[model samples]
Target: MKNVDIDLNLLVALDVLLAEGSVTAAAQRLGLSISAMSRTLARLRAATGDPLLVRAGRGMVPTPRAEELREHVHILTRDAQAVLRPQMNKLDVDALDLTFTIRVSEAFMAFLSAVVVAAVSKTAPGVCLRFAPKPDKDAGPLRDGVIDLEIGVIGTTAPEIRTRFLFNDRLVGLVRTGHWLLAAGDVIRPETYAACYHIAVSKDGNTVGPIDAALHALGLERLIKVVVPGFPDAMRIARQSDLVALVPQSCVGNHQTPDHDAMSGLASFDLPVVIPDFKISAMWHPRRDADPAHKWLRDTVMDICRAAYLQR
Candidate 1:
């Protein structure tokens, strides 16, 4: 048998043909005339020495050889796209209307929503953002391109996923403005912190955390009267009662206005214990790592988060 040399366009055409399963539909997908698509399919059949697709009823089905080659075609097309995308450096953000889906926890959304929305609108008037609740640290959405980005700690990630650090976040104590803890001193001591009734926030529903460990080191433990999944809920409960909640400072934000930014009802203070700060990262599939529009969005988010952290 003789060898056949294939190019990127040929691979893309085959991929589309196999996906659409009809010469007319594939032609539509590739924006080609029916005659041009037929000729291309005829060329493909001759090059591969197989009837790449055949009629099975009123529609076409991929032949066995085509079936076997389908995945290879997809991978090659994606690789070619990734290889060539870096050459595309020009991006008209305001002219392109695209929707980016990002997954994050409730705290992250509350912390960065106002800033991200304002920046994106001011720069990319046509682009929109759709936020999905991050129920877990699953990497499936990023790998499969189901979501554009995932914002969280880089605890673990698939090798193919690309990640960039957004900021380093530390936990702080939150309480209502008139809470008794505020009246104690400028900085609440570990004993003072542990003495108050506490509201613990954990996504995994575990009541124990690093704060608890630090308190235990001092031979003391706080009374955790509540366990909840979200920082906002914890704030709500703490504000209404005498409990103090430890949460990320990033979650407490100000509503922006022309005059000044107004802080939310929740107030934050540094934790008495020395808990390590966790890193927040923006993760995406490598296939989109080099695309100009995607690159802009990623950098934009990193900038917003950095500014927010600086302000706090």
Candidate 2:
């Protein structure tokens, strides 16, 4: 084929002329005068080497070549229209298929996994919720869009992230049922609580937290013998041993706890020293703040957390 340059505008005219047939109607449809349409038709004829439209009895008819090219031009015009159109505003959750990664602590997932899964599955059948373990409080995943949402305490200092309060979380002491602190006649005090071998839960694997600060105010210090990454691990370590695991109240498990030693037959008690309750929150990047599907996810998860954790 010979190389040639053709104005894309001419394709628009060709499509219109083929559809309308009469140059008068085509010109009217394109908001061009009859004389201007005639000039454009002449140019199209010279470029395509075909008088694409010719006079019939009282109007116009498409030439063989024009008819052949009609469908192709129509398709191109439709594609261009789609490309230039605004995005749809509604979220068709049932038709939407996507995998959303959420960063959360193991304890948070353990307490709320069933409700979270059920909510997403019922509303958006094709959506997959990936719950990632929180190894650090870093904002890299949220900033880069690798994590769709974060369900934990909102400690992210990045100014570009947004957070919503889900519920208030309190630290509780967890130990095996027969653990000495829970023995029938023992009256627990800060001094007695501090004397037990302690298991502290910290994401960074450090043996310190707000409980330590509270203890410091009282001129008391607990023996933190073990530091684990999350509540479940702390529970596992404390269950078989005498270590008192400090964790969120929601992380405590009942007799229904499966074979995972982390939560089996664990008993919860009020912390001996007064400590402020921490806020658990849902956080996301501002980049997705107004996205329809993302808004649905954030709203749904927030609702589920409120309904499920209000009891805690």
Q: Best lDDT goes to which candidate?
A: 2
Q: Across residues 1-312, which tens digit of lDDT does each residue of candidate 1 receive?
A: 556566547777887888788999999756799999999999888777899999988988888998899878777776776576445458877786777888886757876777788899999999988888888777876765558988987755578788888877778788877878889778888888898989988778788988889989999898988999887789788767788888775666522321022234556788888989888888898878767888899999988877766454
In candidate 1, stretches whose alpha carbon ends up further than 4 angstroms from where it belongs are 1-89, 254-263, 310-312
What's the lDDT for candidate 1? 0.79
Candidate 1: worst 10 consecutive residues by lDDT? 254-263
What's the lDDT for residue 126 in model 2? 97
Structural similarity to truth (TM-score) of each candidate: 0.69, 0.67
Candidate that would win on TM-score: 1
Each candidate's lDDT (Cα)? Answer: 0.79, 0.80
After TM-score superposition, what is the CA distance of residue 240 in candidate 1 from its true location, in Å? Answer: 1.2
In Å, residue 73's CA in model 1 sits off its true spot by 13
lDDT of 2 by residue, 54-127 (tens): 98899888899999999898779656744653355887889877778889866578777777889899989999
Clashing pairs in 1: none
